[model samples]
Target: MSTLTTPHRPSGAAPHRPYRPSGLTWTVLRLHRTALYVWGAALLAAVAALIWLLAAGPDARAIVGGCDASEPFPIDCGTAHWTTTARIHASGLALVSACVTFQIYAVAVWAGAALTGRELESGTARLAWTQSVTPARWLATRLAVPAVLLTAGTTLAVLLLNWTRRAGRGDLSGGWFTMNVFISSGPVAVGYALAGLALGALAGLVLRRALPAAAAALAAAYVLHEVLDGFRMSLWPAETVTGRAALQLPHGTLVLEHGAVTGAGERLSNNMACVGTDSAAALERCVERTGLTDFWTTYQPESHFWPLQLVESGLLLAVTGLAAAAAFALLRRQHS
Candidate 1:
C-alpha cells in the first residue's frame, strides 16, 4: 500500500494506436520496393538527359543553321550539324523513346510475374485472404499501387519528353507523327502504361503462373501496341490540301494519303512517272494526261497533334478500364 506500483502490460500486447487501413497497400509497396527504386532511377536518368538535350537545343539549332538555312555550308556548321544530329539520333530523342516504350513492357511483365501471378501461384494470395482481406481488396491493392506509381512515372517522362522535343524540335529529324515520337510526347504514354498494368493483371489472374503470365502479358501488350499504331492516324479527320499544280506540303506535315484527284474529286493512285524529275513540264504533262485536276494530299497538320493525342489517349484509357474490370470480375467469380 505504501509503494507506488507501475501498471504491468501484457507481453504479447502492443501499444494501441488509431486504426490505419493502409496495411495492404503498404505491403504491396514494400514487397515491390526494388522495382520502385529501379523505375525511379530510370525516370531520373531520362529527366536529366531530357534537360541536357533541352539546354543543348539552341546550340544544335544554330549548328544546323537555325532550321531554315540550306545545308552544306562551312566546316564549323557541318561539324556542328553532324555532332548535333548524331547526339539526337543516338542519345537524345531515341533514348527517351526507348525508355518510355520499355517502361510499358516492363510494367506488363512485372505486374504479371511479380505482382499477381507469383502471389497466387505461391498460395500467399489465399493466405492473405485468410487474414481478413477479401480477394477484391487484395487485388485492388495490388493493381492500385502499381497503377499509381506507373501513372506518375509515365506522366513525368511524358512531360519531360514533350519539353525536350519542343525545345529541339527544329533540329530534330523526325516528324511529330512518327510512332516513337507520338507515343513518348503526350498523355498516350500514360495511357499505354495503364493499359499494360491492366493487361498484365488480367494475364496474371488467368494464368496464375509467373512465367506464363509474363509471356502472355507481353504478347497482349504487343498486340495492343500494334493495334494502336495502325489506327492512330485514323483518330482524327485529316485535312486535305489540293492544288492544280503540285502542292508543296508544309514541313513536318504527316501525309496520310497523297494522290492525283480529278476536278470532280476522284482520287487516283499517285503518278510515279511525275516523281524524281526536275522537269516541271514533264510533271504537268503527266497530270494533264491522267486527267488529274488537282494534286490532293490528305494530311494531319502539326495543329492536329493534340487532337490525335487526346483521342488515342482516351481509347487507351478505355481499354485499361475494360481490362481492369475484367480482372476484377474474374477474381470475384473465382473467389466467390
Candidate 2:
C-alpha cells in the first residue's frame, strides 16, 4: 500500500549514482584488472628498492671512498670496495635499472596478449561490438585506459629513479651517458612505455592471436629500443674541446670522439700506429709526424643531458602517436 503511493520526485531530480564502470569500458577494465594489479606491484617494488638504495648509499660510498679520486693511475682500493653494503646497493641499482630497461618489452607483451589480442581471439571484442559499442570506441577504450595507467606508472618510476641516482651520486650511479641510466633517468622512459603500448596494440589487432601478437610486439619494441639507443647521442650537437697540451676532460663529460686535428681544423681518424705507442715520447713523435696541431675532443657536457633527454622523448612520443593513429585507422577500416 505504501509502495503503491510511491513518493513523487521532481522531473529534474538526479538519479542515484553507482560506483562502477559502464558498458564496454567497464568490460575492458574488468578483464584487464589483473594486469593492472601486476603493474602496480612491480612499480611498488621498484620504489621500495630505490628507497633502500637511498638509505644504504652513504655506507656504500664510505666503503668505496665514493671513487672520487682523480689520480692518473688506477688505485687498488682493495676488498673494502666490495663490502656487503656496497654489494647490496649495487644489486638494488641493478634491479631498478633492469626494470627500466625491460619495461617496454613487458608493456608490449601485456598489451598484445592480454589487452587486445586475447580479447579479439576469444571473440569477446566481437561480442562487445555487437552490443552497441562501435569498433572505434572499443579500440579507443582499450588504448586509453592503458595509456593513462602507463603514463602515470612510468612517470613515477622515472622520477624515483632520478631521485635514487641523485642520492647515490659519485661512483655509485652510472654515468649520465650510460644507456640504462640515460633511459631511466628522464621522461624518455614514459615515452618508451607509451610507444610500446601503442605498438603492441597495433600488433595485436593485426595478428589477432595472443602468442604471435606478443612475439611481434616484443620484436617491434626491441627494434625501436635499439634504434633510439643508437640515435641518442646525435640528438644534440656536441661541443669540441681543442688543446695543444694534453688536457683532462671536465668530469662527467660524455666524450663522443677524441682524436687529433690539424691547424686547418680538419678532423682525423685515429691512427692505429700512433695509438699503439706505449711511451709518451713515442706518442709525441707520432703526433708530430701526423701534422696534428692539437688534440680535439668532441663531447656532450653534463649540461647537454636535459636537451638530449627532451629530444629523445619527443621523438619517441611522436612514434607513439603514429602507432596509435595507425591502430585506429586499421580498426575503422575493418569495421567499415
The lDDT of each candidate is 0.81, 0.81
Off by over 4 Å in 1: 1-22, 58-90, 170-173, 261-267, 272-292
* lDDT, candidate 2, 207-266, per-residue tens: 999999999999999999999899889999998766532235677887677777676887
Candidate 2 residue 236 Cα shift, in angstroms, is 1.0
Worst 10 residues of 2 by lDDT: 71-80
TM per candidate comes to 0.82, 0.81
TM-score of 1: 0.82
| Deviation from native of the Cα of residue 288 in model 1, angstroms | 5.8
Assess candidate 2 and give its lDDT. 0.81
Query: Model 2 off-target regions past 4 Å?
Result: 1-23, 59-82, 244-246, 261-267, 271-292
lDDT of 2 at 93: 78
What's the C-alpha lDDT at position 289 in model 2? 83
